[model samples]
Structure formats: structure tokens, C-alpha cells
Target chain A: MSQLTPVATTWVNGQVADNLPVTDRGLAYGDGLFETLRASHGSLPLLSLHLERLQRGCSALRIPFQGERIEAELNMAASVVGDGVVKLVLTRGSGQRGYAMPVDAVPTRILAISPLPVYPADRRDGIRLYSCATRLSDQPLLAGIKHLNRLDQVLARSEWQDPAFAEGLVCDQQGQVIECTMSNLFARVDGQWVTPDLGRCGVQGVMREYLLARLVERGEPAAVSRLGLGALHEADQVLCCNSLIGVWPVVRLGDRVWQVGDETRLLQSLAEQVYQ
Target chain B: MSQLTPVATTWVNGQVADNLPVTDRGLAYGDGLFETLRASHGSLPLLSLHLERLQRGCSALRIPFQGERIEAELNMAASVVGDGVVKLVLTRGSGQRGYAMPVDAVPTRILAISPLPVYPADRRDGIRLYSCATRLSDQPLLAGIKHLNRLDQVLARSEWQDPAFAEGLVCDQQGQVIECTMSNLFARVDGQWVTPDLGRCGVQGVMREYLLARLVERGEPAAVSRLGLGALHEADQVLCCNSLIGVWPVVRLGDRVWQVGDETRLLQSLAEQVYQ
Candidate 1:
């Protein structure tokens, strides 16, 4: 009933049907990949970046992704929706109850564009983060891919109901800060821009990928590392970034606090440029 | 399109709708619990066991579950689709795009019935198992519940396309044998029936719960432990079970083979009776 109030346009497998077959593997087994791309003035600003990530995710999940079709669809969707977030869901489609993949799997392509969520103005000043008790389980095989199986993130996000707690930081089993409930994390420690390594768990968001490369291109010492709480405490700055939000300066994380630093501001501006 | 054959009746949230809203959280984030029950002469024998597991799973996931509505629905489904399989899917329903639960989540109830799949005559003898390379990720929070997030089993089952191999046995990251892709596993190691502990990962199947209880009642020691490949190889007999396939002796797992032992045979008979 809640989802009945469709906020944006939706297309399923090139058709405008929002009702999917119940047997779709994406529902039965969460066998799929998804990408959330930012649209600006009828064009996907980071189309290539999102498509690249989606392709890699498809390869890892063995979901046959038709890149050309998706690119065309995204462009069409961007032109239609204009300014919002475009969501593309690629699933292995319907299958029998058994876990075995159907001999001839027809992948399902779902494209939806929704109005960008309005963030509170305080978020720009940097939002408060809750250290979620719901830990991200180490799954090296499924790590870094934005697969539909996101119960960990769902559970982590469910931890706090307060609006003040804009996000939650989740750790892997080994106590390494992997990511926020919805974004990838980075902290400047000892003059190095270190993002959490997603080799074990967490999604390497498209924005995070872009910013990491941008930092390196600027001749900044940027690298992926297994970050811990201590790293945040010792860092000069901490921030979280995602395609939808661009970059948010995490000024407060429970008891630990950090002022928005120059590196974070530069990255934010660079990310906004890229997102634009 | 293959699923359009409507061999079974389907009802979505009290309405006879075969198609589900694509926005269903079950499809979105795998936020759901499901039960597949075997019906004999229009009656579900192990309804309590299945319902109990579903309840527990819903509770763990923080999804609202209405037992009374489901019980009435099951009875209605049982009468309509006599002597077949009754499937129940409980999803957090559709919601806004985010991990946060809907302020008012009207959980979706999906009921479908399908004709019981035919098994080969040789199935009574035993089946060979494949040791899949895809390992089940360790997530104690999601362990034991047959949630919609089943990509691990899907990947594992995809490892072997050979129909000769009935199922694939999966392991946790620690290399401990967990369960078959579609069923629970048990091995008579050192004269005790030991099922792999689902403390880390794996679905605690309905048939497994019944078999374990029955085995204990008969004074045949049955327990759960962190089972390893070595333990299975050293076992006198190994077997797999599910609600649909009562109990089948696992005569082969890779190169390690074993005869259908007395314990397995006895359990098979008892399980068959329960299934009937």
C-alpha cells in the first residue's frame, strides 16, 4: 500500500509495467544488480561511471547485462525524468523455486526515476552518524557489488529511527569501518586520503570510485585501507559519499567529531562537478 | 514469460494477483520470509512447524507478521490446491527507496500452489552431491531464517548443471559444511546424526526441524555442530532433506561415497510417514 503512491516513472523490461512476475529471481533469491544514477537537466551526468560499475557487478553475479540497451534506456529515462535519481535494476528474472538457475534465464530490466530526496540543510554542515551494532558480515565473494541482497544495510539503517541520525556507520566482523548504511566512507589520516577497503564487505559506490581516482589524479596520497574507529578518531577529516548525496562531511559520529577539512571540501566540490 | 503458464493459483495480499508490485521490498532488498509446504489431500501436515519458522524469521527481520490471517489463508489455499505444494511469501511489502522500514508497512502475503514436481524412481535409492566453490557468507543475524536473500544458494546450485548431481553442498567462510542448496544436511559421524550448525549461515529447513525432533524422540542422538568436509568424508552415512523431498541418502559427495546406511534408511521411512 505504501509503494502504491508511485513518486516517479517506472519501466520494466522496456515496458511500463510496474507489476513484476512473482517468480522473478530478484524477489525469490535477490539475484540481481542495481545502479542509482544522478540525472541533471535531462542527461545522466555520470552515465559511463554507473554503467561501468553495473557491468562489473553483472560480471561478478553472472547476470547477463545488455550494456547498449541499458545505455539507450538510461538516456531515454534521463530525458524523460530530467532532474532526479534514475534507478536501474537488473535481475536474473524468474526461475523455479529451486536455487539452480533456469537453463534459459531471461534477465529483467527495471528503470525508475524518482525525485531526489530533500536533505536537511544541517546535512551540508555535516550530519551526525550512529555506529550501528548491526555489523556487515564479511563476504569477499559478494563484496563491492550493489547486489539486491542488502539485509545487512537494511538492518543497519533500521538501528536508529531518529531524523538527526542521518546515517549509520557499519563495520565488518573484524571491526573495520567498511561503510555507512548507504554510502562509502573515507577519512584523512596522517595526511593520506584513505577510503575503507571493500575487499571483504561493503559496496564501492560509483561516487566513491570517482572521488578516489580524482584524489589520486590530483597527486594526493589516496588509497584503500582497512579503516577502524581509531582511524576516524585520529583523522583530520571524515566524510561519506554516494551517487545520490554526492559527498557529506560526517562532522559527528557518536562521541567522535571532526570539522569539515579542506580535502573534504575539495572532494565535495569535485564530486558535485562530476555529479553535475 | 515462462512463469505466465499459471499452473497454480496466486493471491497477493488477499487479492488474486499473480503479479507483484516491482517495488516490493522483497524484490528491492530481499526483505521477506517465505514458506514452502507440502500438501497431501489438501491438508498441510506440518503447518505448525512452517508457521513457527516463518514467525521467527519475521520477528528477526522486524517485519510485522499476522499469524491469524496467514492461518486462515493457508487453510483456504490448502482446500483449493489439494495434494500439491502451497507456497507463502511474506514481504515487508513496498516502501520508499531506502533501507528504512515504511512508517506503516502493510506486509504483503503471497499464496501460490503448484503441482508437486515428479522425481525419478532412482531418487529413493540416493543422490550424488556436488561440493560447490561458492561459499555461504557468515551472517549470524540472518542465519537459520529462510529469508528472500538466497543468492549464495543460487550461485552454489549454478556451479553444476549436470542433472545427475541432485544438489550442491555449501560451506561457510571457515570451510565448515553448512547445507545442500535446497535442503538441510545430516551425516552419521561416529554413530551420531550431526547436522551442520546454522549459527553462522544456512537455512534451517522445515523438514530438518521435524527430522531432528523425530530423531531425538526415537532416542537416536541428533545434534548440530560445525561440520567440516572431513567429517562428512568420515561419516558412515550422509543424507539431505527438505519439505518436498522428505529424505534422500547422499550416496555421493564429490569422490567420497557411502552406502545408504541403516540410520539413513530409518530416518527416511519416518520422514516419509511424516510427509504423508
Candidate 2:
């Protein structure tokens, strides 16, 4: 673990610990939801957006939402995290040996700050993506929410260790493109920016939602729909977006290569202005 | 959370700590494997079996499994427990942001002992089961292994709050009976013991494997195959098995009552002899 540094600092519940308790439901059963935010100059770019998604996930998981308490903690962590990543983990707290949840559950809130990842400038120009063999399982109940059950992502990410492959685009069981391993995907098809629907599977990305809302507010031709894997190849350009890494254009996916297109450039520039 | 009593003692990475490091991957991404073993009289009844399964899970997840190191720690933990449940959690230790695993990954070993849960005497005779609305997603890669991704089970168990319903029988998206929330399921159909295949979803319980093996050795008629939801209702008897709950005859599943059969009695007696 020496090659990569962990959290710069961490707060468990409200205080620092040697680590979290071994019995924490998050660690025990992956019973939790998390948000990874981009922090710059001691400020979170999309803090509220991330919190909104987390709130939705908490509500879906039936965990009591303490929005004000979370925001207070977020502000404290954001102050120290200047130009880094702030990861917030909310777990169903500790539990006994059974799968049944406790009645009076005190949700454990974990906030951690890590140094910002430095990627090559060329990556923003375009990144090669691997078509992962690990397909996203369809489960409407867990779909769209960034829950802790991320083994599918782990397996998909592990498909290729080659740094040449910056990321992996995965599909559902029926060959429908869901999303990339880490980011939400968008492809310009028939002169419209179309993104995969996260109704059955995939994380309802914060950046994806932000851009969709932005597109709608600005009256841009874009859609969130079921996209087949073949549709991606037929599309004019493919773009991946996430809060951590604003937007990445897909230059190549295996043999299919895409030049930095007009629409992709427009979105990329918009990302920079939005970040600013 | 306060109502549920935590482990009697815990060992994190060979040393006792106030809690686990907040950055551990198990808590962060649910990148871990765990085993809940039955320890009695300062000894684990299924220590080797649990280790075998954990090793398989580690191999599948590409995490280096340290068998001797884990065994040493388990023995040390088991010695102090006397009689209870021993939970061993192995995680791909702390790392920087991103799903790409660290090169110098040091797997964290957590050993915890919790008091044995006291089940009702009538549970052995038969238990009522709730047919959960939460259907298990089909993910062949994660099937059968007791990895930390258990939100499906958590959701299924949460379907019913009534204490009268001891467990819930969950089906996959294909309407095939998978397993109980925390235990493996079996039914005597056509006078033969059969279990739902774990090829798609569901944890392969240690007790279930043990009984299957015992049946094979004794020349008993038992097989693991596809079991649809309708098959459970048409079965002669239903049984639930887990390391913690040895063997529970499931007499009722949502008004579909079943009488205790010869196969269920034989299995119960065998479980007692095995535990002895």
C-alpha cells in the first residue's frame, strides 16, 4: 500500500479513530452509500449535488437522513481538503450477527480527505476504454444509487491492469451499454447527446445528472435512455463524465477510434467553465 | 446500534485497536471476504471449512490469501471466545482514491468474537418464512461466495419486521428460489433432498455444504439444481441451514404450511450428532 497514500485524515462518526469498529455494518455487509467529491481551493465544486444523491440513497436504504448534520461535517472536512478529494461514507452502523437491521440504528458517518489524483494532460484529450467482460447485473431496487455493493465495479476494473486502458465501459446482461467503470457515459447519436438510463443498473452519477439538468435548462438535444452497445459504435462521439474527473472524451475503445469531435470539445470547454 | 451488543473482543491486523482504520477498503468499497464460524469450547467446529471458502473467495477476487497467518490469528481468537461466533474479515487494505488496486497491497485481517445467538426451541421444529419482495440479482461472478456485498440480503430481511417470521426466502430475478436471507435453502421434493443451485446468486452456507457432503457419503438421495418458486410449495418439506443456525425445518412460508417429514427429522438428528 506504500505506492498509494490513503486518506490524508479521517473522521469516524465525529472523531478520528485508529480505524472504524470491526463490527461496522459498512465493513461487515457493505451496508452503506458513499460520495466522492472534487475539492479545489478549500471548496467543494458540487458539494450540494453530491449530498442530494447521498440523501436519496439514504432514503432508499431507509436510513434516517440528517442532512444538516452531514452538511456541517462536510464543511469542516472541505476546509482542510483544499484541492483534493473528499469521500463521505454513511453506514447503517454496527449490528449483531444477523442480517436483520437494528430498530434504533445510529448511522455512522465517515468523512475522509485524500490528495487529488494527477492524470496526464493527454487523458483529458481522450482516454482509451476497455470493454469489460463483467456485465452489470440488473436490479432496479439498487440501481442509480451509489451503494457500497461495488464488487461488480471492482471486477470490471480488474479486467485489465494495463495503464494503456484508462477505464472500462460495461454493459448490462442484455448487451445494453450501462456506464463506464467509474464515470457515466454519453454518446452523440443521430446528432443528439444520448446517455444510458440507470433505471435497472449503473450509478446515477452526480456529474451526469448535473449535465443532464444543464442540458435541459439550456434546451440542448440530449437524452437519458436505454442504449445498446452497438449504438455507442454508431454514435458520432462518446464522452464520459464524473464529479472527480469532469469530462473525458473517448478517443478509442479497442479498435473503434473517435477523433475529438465538435460536440465533445463543446462539452469539455463547458466542463472547464463549470469547474471554474 | 446500541441495542446490538458488539463483539466480545476484536483483533485488527494482529493488534488490538479502538477501531479499524477509516480508510480500509472493506468499509470504503466492500472489497473484502468474511466468514462467520461456530466456535464452541474454545474451538471452531468448521474452522478449516471456513478457511477453504475464504481462500476460494480471495482467489476469485485476486486478493492474496495468507492461510497460515489467518489460521494463527483464528486460533488465538477462538481460544478466548470459548463459545460463540467468530467472524474473520479479510480486506484489501488502505489505498489511494480509485478502484485500481494498489501494488503493495497489505490485506487487513480482522478477527472478532460475538456471543452465540440463542434461537427459540421451536425454531428447530419449524420456522415461518417471509417471501421477500427484494429479489436477488443474478451475478454469476459473485454467486456462492460469502463476500461482503450483502445489501440484497439486508433489503430482503428488512422486508418483514415481524419477529414471528424468522427468515425470508428470496428468489432471483428469474423467479428461481435462491436462498433465505442468511441461510441456504433445501427441500425434500419427490422424497429426495434438493437445494437451490447457487450458480446465479445466494451464499453457499457452510452448513449446507457440510450436509450435502454428508448425504453424498451416506448414499442419500440429494442434489443441487434449479428450484423455482412454485417448487417450494409443492415440496414435501423445506429446511434452512447456516453455521449459526444449524438446521431449521421451515414448516411455513406465507401460509403454505408443511408438516415435519422423515428427511427433515433425519437431518436434524444428523446435525445434533455433528455438532456433538
Candidate 3:
């Protein structure tokens, strides 16, 4: 048996450890929130933004947040790998087998560092998208936050094995376009940028939120609009983005193909300034 | 510092361990299947049924099934606690940070034993139901299996703190009644026993399946029907059932109220024969 290097720094009650107690609610009910970030030269450019999102998620879920300890763990993870990906998981800790959160339970924090994923060379050129049939549920309470409950994405990703299809576009139960399986989607409609409103469904991706801010700063009119399937056919440009992968333009959606547009390229360059 | 007994018996590749390696996919994305069984005198009634469901879920998700080892571990868990609730968790095991399932992953198994949760004294009399605003997603692939992704139920359950309201009834995005937060729902409509079809949404509860089979064997036709909020309101009687709770009649649903019915009592007696 090969010994695996300690990839995670786990904290139970303020002290960092190598493992979590078996009853962690994170492992049980997936009672947790995770943040995946790209680190460059032992520092994360959007570290504060990532933490802000994590805090917001915690607040929404009623999970207690320990920002100082989480920051310490992040530093420890970054120190191990100067330039890599750092994944932070905060769980409600161990509890009895019931659904009720333990009254005085201390939350568990886990931070893991790994080598950065190798992005496709053609990612810069643009990516091809598949319109998946799997639809996201509309749960306003759980919307707009990154949580551990991601079965919808897993099922959608499992639908195809063709490496050529970079990602799949997922719609809501109402047949409204929501997002890609892993990334938030944006489209250029009539020379203006528009993205789906995640208030009802889909995750409000960190990078997408950042890009929207950049678009506003550049004096570009970007709207949080509810997209229909017909809108994709009429769009000038389509793109997908997440925190890890800054931004990727969509060159094709099923049979319809479009050349990479200037707006997509501009957003990519702006996100790259912070991501790389 | 005080030491607490571990609530779970964890196994990694056949050896007993408390903490799963930080790379467990269950922790990363909730990539897992779970079976909760009632154990009496070190023997589980309907063990085969639970195993069949687990195997079916694993096959559906393309996770490798190791039935022999699972049975052995379950036997070990049964030996630890002669009578209680036994929960079996099978995760896709450890993998690098990504959604792609590893080609060769030894699935991680967790066996936890907990005392049976105490039910409210009047549960046999009836339970008050709350109409939840959280809508269930229409995903056929995940509808019937008890997978680990359950954020929707968690959020719905968190919506209320009133002990009078036993459980919440959820609906689909189209406003069709689906199931309760953690249990399958049934109603008496037009002198027929009808339960919401799980082909589009909701987890197929093991007890619900068992009761349906018993009803059929007794020459009673229990239809798997699609229900709407209006249908539920018009029902003569309503009940909920799961592995943990044999059967609970609904006494009140907002302004509408139901009384304990003959069919509910008969199903409860049948479940008791198997559980007790």
C-alpha cells in the first residue's frame, strides 16, 4: 500500500489535525460549505472575496463561522504548495443520527492543498457546450451559495463522456436556462451582457460575481436576466466561468456554433489579471 | 478533555478506522449512497431489500459494488449493537479534487449505530403537516435512490421550529405534491390508497415500498399517483412513512384535518410485524 501524503489540515476545535472524527455532519448529511481557490506565489488574489462568500453561505445555512481559524488554516495549506489549488470545507461537525443540528456542536474545518489542475490549451480559444437535460431545482433558500449538495451537477456531468464537450448547460425545472454543470453562464444579447438570476436556482459563482462587478466598472450594461432556451440561439456570444477557471468562451452550443466575440475576450483578459 | 464513544464504525479497504482519509469523495461532493435499517436482536428485517436498493443505487451512479464485504461489515456492525438503527454509508472513496470518478477507487464504508429516535406520544394518533415552500427538483435518475445530496430537505426542515408541526410536505417546481421532507407521503383519495409517484421526484422509501407490496398482496390496489396541492387538500386521510417511523397519520394540514384511518392502522400493524 502506498502512503498518501497529508493533503488536508483538519481542525476540530481550534487545533489542526490530520483527520476528522467519524461522525462529522459534513460526511453524514453533506452539512457543509466549500470554497475552491487558486493560489499564486503562496497568496490568493481573491482570498477576501472567497471568505466573504463562505461567510455568506454560513450565515444562510446557520453554520457558525470562525474566520480567524479558517484564515490560519488557509495560510498553512498555501505554505505547503506555493502555487496550487486550496479547498476549504467547513462542516457542522459530529452529531447524533438525526437531522437536527447539535445545540453545542463545534464545527469542523478542513483545508487541503493540491497541484493546480492542468487547463486545456484550447480553453483560451473557447469551449464547446452540450445542452444537458438535467434540470436544477428552484430552492430560493439554498440558492446563490456554494454548498456541498451537488448531486444535480454530478448527474449532469455523468450524462456524457466525450472529452470534446467541455461542459454541459443545465436548465431549471421551469425550462429556463440556469448555468453549466460547474460554471455560471453568461451571454451577450443585443450587444449587452446578460446572465441568469440565481435567486431561484443555480449557484451564484464567485468568479461570475466578480466579472459582473468588472463589467459595471468598465461602463458595460450587464443585467441579471432570466434566460430562455430561445435566447441562446439569438445571443451574440456565450461564455462560462468559475473561480478556478477564470472565464471560458463558448464557441458552440449543440449544433449552433459562433466565433469568439470581443466581449468574451475582454472579460477573459480582465478575470485573468486576478486569476493567474 | 473528555473522550466520547465514536458514533460510527468506519472501514477503509476492510480495516476499521475512525477518520476517512481527507480525500474521500463523499466529503468532497457527497458522492455516496446510504441505507438506514432497523435492527432487532442482531438481525435486520428486510436486509435483502436494503442491500438490493443500495446495489441499485451504486449501479445507477456507476459506483463499483462490493456486496460481500458490505455484508460482512454490516454483520460486524449488527454484532456491536444488538438492537438499534444501523446506518450504512458507502462513498466513492478518496480522489483528487475533481468531479471525475477515479478508475480504481476502493469505496469507503461507514457503519453507524444509534438508539432509535423517540417519536412524539401522539404520533400514532396523527401528525400536523406544514406546507413547505421548498420545491423538489424533477430528476428521474436520482428520484428513487437515497443518495447523500439532501440540502433541499435540510432547508425545508429548518424552515419551522414548531413542535406541533411534525413534518413538512414538499412539492415539485410545477406545484405538484411530492413527498415529506424525509418520508414518503400517502393519502386516501376517493376510497383509494394513493402515494405520489417517485418517477419524477422524491426518494422511494424502503418502508413505503414494503407497505405497497403488502397492500398489493392483500388485494388492495395502492396506486403510484401524481398529486397536486389541491388533491392533497381534498384527501380524506393522509399519512407519512419511512424506515425509521413505521407510519404516521396526518391529523392537520393547515386548515384541513384528517383522522386516523383503517388503512393507516393496517399498514402500521404490518410494519410492526416486520420491525418488532
Which candidate do you rate higher for lDDT, 1 or 3?
1
Instruction: Give candidate 3 misplaced runs (Cα > 4 Å).
Output: A1-16, B1-13
Interface RMSD of 2: 1.2
For model 1, the superposed segments whose C-alpha errors exceed 4 Å read A1-8, B1-8
lDDT of 1: 0.86
Instruction: For residues B11-122, write the lDDT of model 2, one tens digit per residue.
Output: 7787764377777888878999998888778788777888889988998788999999898778767777778777888998887767877788899988788788988889
Per-candidate TM equals: 0.96, 0.95, 0.91
Q: Higher-lDDT candidate among 2 and 3?
A: 2
**How does model 3 score by TM-score?**
0.91
Instruction: Sort all candidates by TM-score, best to worst.
Output: 1, 2, 3
Model 1 / residue B129 / CA error / Å: 0.8
TM-score for the first chain in candidate 3 comes to 0.93
- Cα error, residue B129 of model 3, in Å, equals 3.1
lDDT for position B15 in model 2: 74
Backbone clashes per model, in order? 0, 4, 0
DockQ-based class of model 3: medium
Task: Point to the candidate with the largest lDDT.
Answer: 1
